[model samples]
Target: MADTIISNHGSSEKGANPLPANSVIVVLGASGDLAKKKTFPALFGLYRYDLLPKNVKIVGYARSKIEEDDYKKRISAYIKVLDDKVKKQLEEFLSFNTYVSGQYDKDESFQVLTKHIEELEAGATEPHRLFYMALPPNVFTVVAQHLKRNSYPKNGGARIIIEKPFGHDLASSRELQTSLEPIWAEDEIFRIDHYLGKEMVKNILILRFGNEFLGASWNKNHISSVQITFKEPFGTEGRGGYFDQFGIIRDVMQNHLLQVLTMIAMERPVSFSAEDIRDEKVRVLRAMPIIDPKNVIIGQYDKSDDGTKPSYLDDETVPKDSRCATFAAIVTYIKNDRWDGVPFVLKAGKALDGAKVEVRVQFKDVTSGIFKDIPRNELVIRIQPSEAVYLKMNTKLPGLTTKTSVTELDLTYKNRFKDLHIPEAYESLILDAINGDHSNFVRDDELDASWKIFTPLLHYLDENTDIIPAKYPYGSRGPAFLDDFLASYGYVREQNGLYNWPHTSANGKL
Candidate 1:
């Protein structure tokens, strides 16, 4: 039997606090990389901020036969403590932690695990339960079913947290859902997309809905096109085996990129509830036109001149004859009342020139060139490598030659707010799950709709290997044809000298 420890914290004001501190959390696959590097650290961060309930107990479940102290030691190796104060706080929080060894597929093991949790929280005030699946997608259903059959609390709030890649495509996702539906309700299941929890990603909603200036111009009449890009400089390294299996399309474009696009394009919800927000997002996703093959481009990294890195096929883990795409760029269209005829281009790759994640909304050029020298207006939302919002528009030059040049109205987080710590993506997401705020969680319908749009392209690529991925050198700005790809659609690359997309379409053309 596990020791039952009790701790008390301040009470909440009213219905605002739906979950209690005495809630029990069971993290399946607690020994995995994600659990050690992300989940435990995130939970500790929340504990340090007192965002978690004081009486809470975390049960680390895995098949590994490790002692409690040893497990903590292993986790501590990767846990990041930015300050000495946080280090001390994390130590205290870890005291309430316990571990349970169990075979994922065995019922008897899960029952024992349940009894241990019951003993640990024997005297807790509330018996709320949250089951977080940190394991791979393959074991999600098994763990969910076991928990439902043997461990779910009969009373109070019961929730399950699932991580992505939810499924390879729609059918698998639906099957995954069906397997869990018997155990959890839609409201009780939180499907996390870490990108949705990013500080800047959340700001997408705040920027568009909270500000009058941007909101007024966010429509088909004023915007030309929206471009979103997620690029990284590092290749797959030793992880090419997994990368080859999933490819850039399913790995990044399917969930992260699509979620970002939906957030930017969705109509304003009546309330900020999970369902309300997801409903609007589904509408936009459903409205997105089927991707035209002619508008899509794919690429793979070629060996560098200096031979410092291996190409995709050269990686030993990846099959030599594989035709998986390492890079994907597509132009999407959203046919709706507010965004009809607008072009939304999305581009993502593993090894690129620099680490960049940004959304550029290029506004239509001035109908009448009041200032002959003025450039087009634009709004940029930089999500990573830096977090900032900039409004680019025409402004009079200091000199007197009647020249107008583009200038930016910048609001940078690091510059304006000094020493402020934005929590990691996992931290924000775990905290939201603890609080039962599903606003950032993905919905089942949304997942299905996303797969519907991309499954065709995925199958098309799998069937046709002749559409080979273009070869581009590592640390370069992708294939040289990127500019020509955009040019074919009547859009000119901007002065930023970078070929990327913005958060929302600036002028609604592609």
Candidate 2:
């Protein structure tokens, strides 16, 4: 299949310059875990695939002072060197990477960093610079200001990429945006919601707009409810301090799950342009009502049933009296005509049954008296652990009898695309930033609208300490109110819905 044409503003034209002629990819907070584990590994992945600019230089910037050899070792720790040939390529990739240590807020340090970058440019004209922020939120604004004031590219364009925990809530998010907007243009800043970079999440646009049946039925009239969920089997363990401050809602639901929900509920854009797609997402968010506290469920994990695992409060890093919600299930509704009465449920938590992320779209029940409360059809899109798109439809039981049973038309990536390479989310996103594509990256206005949808609820949860989170045992399936909460929004499971379809072969046939 040929590449789909993207007509978004600032997007590259087909067959045009795939990469900037002269550029440096700099990873700020290079000494941190995120940088070593995800940033450098993703950069190496792009270099291995020959996706980076031929003459590009890579730089690691952080406050930790380390020798060049140690810096290389740290960044390359997560990369798989594999065979001798791959090891040689790894050496070559590292040769292009250099490191610089400096205070994030110090102008003198940034100036030194700027001089180092200039020395590497070696008289190249108009070299572009891509700055990735892997640091904590506390220093985001100061780092942005310092970079803008001291190290911005002299001739070529500059792009800054930063990850989430964008803010504790809307007010602080606005403050963060305000600080950066002055230092960089809205187009120059690429806010990272790595979930948007996932293989299947990226496919949502294609699945919805490319298929007529799915597109036509993706609305309130045909769909009964939509759910976006994130589950993890393990708790924060010893690192509960950071997790305690924001809880599950801020950590996942506010940004990651909300972004996924927008993709699932957004109307089709006029064209495959970043601006148009994001415009649609903002529209959906704007039409949705603020999430009500009554429709929200919060929970904290206690000891496991067997008493082996410890509770969230037992973690030494977590405050004993913390009211932070480790688990949250919030029901939201869109007031727009396209999805007037449809319910969109967003769930995310730590220490659950398993780890997975998925979007489920349940269609309305059969409008007939012949079948006894037949199960509604559903379209499931699994984003991680295994990537698949399967549709649950009721079919006649394979027997002389006329009984109905649920079977799925499945498209599991492993089964369908053998030997396929699904790039890491960070890999896809970093390459998009380098190529000047904003389709997968979040826009400023989109971020604002997302915060607007949840700000009130966040404030409420913060101010009212009396509204304690319900307790659920660790490793259990969230709160005991899970079923009741879901039922309130019309999520009903039929008695016969337990039947499973036979696993399909590589050819997609039973």
Tens-place lDDT per residue, model 1, 174-253, is: 99989888778998889998998889998787788877988898998988888899999989888899888789999999
Lowest-sum lDDT 10-residue window in model 2: 8-17
| Model 2 CA deviation exceeding 4 Å by range | 1-19, 494-497, 501-510
Cα displacement (angstroms), candidate 2, residue 260, comes to 0.7
Model 1, global lDDT: 0.82
Candidate 1 error regions (>4 Å): 1-17, 496-510
Candidate 2, residue 41: Cα displacement in angstroms equals 0.7
Residue-level lDDT tens digits of model 2 in 287-353: 9888999899999999999999999999999999999999999999999988998889999988999
- TM-score for model 2? 0.95
- Residue-level error in angstroms, candidate 1, position 19: 2.1
